[model samples]
Target: MNFLDGILFALFAEADKSAPLMVPDSVQKANFAETVRKLANLDVDQLLQNLLSESVWILIKVLIALAIYFVGRWIVRRIIHLLDAVCERRRVDVSLRSFLRNTVRVVFTLLLVLIVVSTLGVNVTSLIAVFSAATLAIGMALSGTAQNFAGGVMILLMKPYRIGDYISAQGQSGTVREIKLFSTVITTVDNQTIYIPNNSIATAIIDNYSTADVRRVDWTVGISYGDDVDTARRTILGMLAADPRVLREPAEPVVWVSALADSSVNLTVRVWTKNTDFWDVFFEYNERFYKELPAAGINFPFPQMDVHVKNE
Candidate 1:
């Protein structure tokens, strides 16, 4: 053989002596079986110890979360009590105080829940996202109720009417009893209870009669055309002067000839009185005018027409 042949023969011999690169199927199976055996023979005591440690850690977290919740609840109650005392000291309105208290409680409770959940290793961001989505869905579902809630906030803030105030709104007239989160409760003159939605009342015109210390009472008295107007006026003026509830500071009672109708003359009587005495004075004086005017030689004229008949 030549030198090149000798070199090639040496290379082939070296290649023949080298081990195969790929492992056999039998060797792979043996290795897998050996690995599974090693795993199965692992120390059971150590595994149990690891599991117990994990459980203890979880228990500690749970206990901590409970502690936080209880502490937060106590703090929230203390805060609410302080707020109530402050409100009382300031003499805040009942409706506003109630609203503020409820709002503060709810806000603090939600914050406490979030904090407790975070202490439990819960993802607070994900929970808040979930809460936000749920709130949006609920808001859309109860849009009218949401509007009423907002209206209630506005009503409490603006103070258009308060408890025990006689108010007229949305074709309902009553004395306000309670201002709630979504509605206003009122009692009518006839002793009927009504719940008016705050959204409706907030947007409607509200006539509060109890706001002013005094109110004006007006009456229209009609007498026959030929009856003595001066006598009727004098009689009404005397009755008004005798009433102790009538106010004289702003303006004294006055009678004016308002209009002359076909059969009778109309006299306008205006008087001022305390708000509490308005209705009583108005009704009592009406009966007095009906009886006293006639006793004073004044006549109440009814609509009458003369009929003429011609016989042919």
Candidate 2:
């Protein structure tokens, strides 16, 4: 008999206490082997059916997730495009408009990702928690950058300065070239480009030269003490009057004796001109004053020293 037959026969003998057991070991072994085989077959069949059903369900979920992603992305793009059209119609500032577009896209994309994760049976709450922690860590790591971003947003909203406006801040003067999320780009008079942090600019004093429609140009002209102050003032006034760009109604060109220097009389000439023509008017007036003053018998005083040395 096989090992299974021997084991089964011994078990039967132990159960019967009144008389010795006489069952054949071969039959017991065969019966036990057949039962085990039947159970194994049944389990294998059940397991295969369950696996196939689960695989189909998982595939359907995956397809649904993919569909949601594509449709959601298309919707987001359409909404952003519509917003752009509205902003353009409203004549929104370009800097703020671009910032809004990017912000909306990022927020919507994140929402879409969460929806997709949920469709795929992922725990969204846990995902959100993880993202929150990551964001906090990143914010801590880049505190200054975050401050600059906030400052930029404030600047765009408040409009302290706009593109093409000449500004002086932090000891630097230039025309605003671009306003970004974290920095402002400026182009200097000499064609040099500079990038200033938004935080610094927003917090510090800003002098915007182009905020007004017109600007005042002031020049101090010095003439020899012997020269006629009236003649000098008249000459300067005539030059200003000749410039068509100079504004007259609000306040005409002002010329007055500002001071009496050691060897000359200083005349302060103030004129109002359109912002666009300010620089041109300033240079033109300066050149004319220097050239015409001498022709009008107005002498510019120069420092002179005369020493009378005796036997000392």
Candidate 3:
């Protein structure tokens, strides 16, 4: 009994000497216990059960987002339509409408994508930064195509020429068959297809012959120096008169000595005719002049080297 009492005394002494371990009083202890119970984490099964309890909320949020998107799409379409109507009222070019519509659609779709990403808790700024960097690379890589695109825009805006117009542009002479956003497609008289870069065509001089109803036809006929100029001129004039396709009353066809060459005099015969008939008149008139000049005592000149052999 004495040993037991001594041990008990030592335990009490040690407990007394140590700092007091604070514990909540009865009321605070009950409150803390209750709070812990309230704040206790749910098990996975419980969490899943809670989520599945009412999917209506999630669906509602998604539906709202989708509704907003659909409404926005409708609004965008309406806006595009309005833009076209306004353009039509204002007499805007057809090409302008296509460019504007495409731009609007792209911009609006980008906006929609941003909204959707933001809804999904994704950072849009980072995406935009990445896209911007990627776009810079793409733009640099397609610099030549971009130049052609800009050239196409300039071509459309400046109204230098249009489809179905006969033109000589960018070292190409043909009828403009298609004026696309990147290049102009042309069909030559010989049925050759020519694709001219829009930028090159935009920067170059464009000769639109179809703008005029009549085109001047020039015929050059060379005669031996000894041939009578007056008689040759009259004969050429008579040949032109025989062709009914030639235009008259352009103050009489001009027949003048154009040049004095090494062995012949070149006569310039210029007349006007319908643009469509220009080629036909050119070839026919040339053929007639060739046949008639010899009959009219006019000698056509040729390259001749007089060789004098020295007697050795």
Candidate 4:
């Protein structure tokens, strides 16, 4: 046999020369209690041989377990790399690729651990039972975390928004920077970072501004009531037409008298432009309307009170 086995055999041969160990009559009759009692009566030579034999078997088992673990790790890495290549060929989203890779790694690693434990002679069935019970208890205690995790999966699948998309949800609006397993990170217009739980975002009303190629910009321009409505409309339309960023095919820019308030007549102007140019067109046109309308002899309205004194 091997070196360790040969050594053990030699030791056992020497131990056999000692006075033959007494066998209890109950043990001969296959009584478990008598077998246990006979174990206490084992001579020093017999006990030493038994301990060495068991220890050698355990060491061999440990070596085999270590070999499996190391080989399994190498195989796991190759599998994950192949998975990444497949995902890339399928054109998966960057966030989704990360999630899938991590999930596969965890599942494979857990299976490897189980295999190693089984090699060590652990009872797989009892271990699974204990694991299941512990998992149930933890799930009950961390319900919110579990919900968030589920929500993350939903977000990745449903794709309500993606990284770099500007979205407004749960009373927070920002450009998404990352979509993690539990939360989404966004950077606000003012450059503030916000972490929103995926659960809340999934259930909230999401306004994804980046979904559409073009968006409508609306502004209300108020002029003095006496100002000519036709002139004001023409002036606003001219300004819209002058801006190259404004879209003209699907929708044409239009202005209408929306409200005749106490001080002014409000003209609502609506125009379509590329999403990227929405804010630029709105802010620039606001200043343009202020300067161009007044220059066109249309005065802005101001609050005024009429007073008449009656002398008795």
- Relative to the unseen true structure, what is the C-alpha lDDT of residue 26 in candidate 4, on a scale of 0 to 100? 60
* Cα lDDT of model 1 by residue, 29-98, tens digit: 8766766676577677875776688789889999999999999999999999999999999999988987
Deviation (Å) of 78 in candidate 1? 4.2
Of the candidates shown, which would achieve the greatest lDDT relative to the real structure? Answer: 1
Off by over 4 Å in 1: 1-78, 112-124, 305-312
Q: Over 4 Å off in model 2, which ranges?
A: 1-78, 93-95, 112-124, 305-312
Q: What is the lDDT of every predicted structure here?
A: 0.89, 0.86, 0.79, 0.87
Assess candidate 3 and give its TM-score to the true structure.
0.62
Worst 10 residues of 1 by lDDT: 8-17
lDDT of 3: 0.79
CA shift of 169, model 2, Å = 1.4
| Candidate 2 collision pairs | none
Put down candidate 2 lDDT per residue, 151-182, tens digits, no spaces. 99989988999988999999999999888778
Q: What is the lDDT of candidate 2?
A: 0.86
Q: What's each prediction's TM-score?
A: 0.71, 0.70, 0.62, 0.70
For model 3 the local lDDT of residue 278 reads 87
- Pairs with steric clashes in candidate 3: none
The CA root-mean-square deviation of candidate 4, after full C-alpha superposition on the true structure, stands at 8.0
Which residues of candidate 4, in runs, are more than 4 Å off? 1-78, 112-125, 303-312
Q: What is the C-alpha RMSD of each candidate to the true structure, in Å?
A: 13.1, 10.9, 13.5, 8.0
lDDT of 3 by residue, 1-312 (tens): 343354345434423335457744874577566555544642567545656754655677677778778888888899889988998999876656666766677788889878866665568899999999998999999898899889988887887876678899877899887767678889998999999998888889889988778889998889998889999988888877777777885656889999998778999999988899988888887888889899989999896677899999
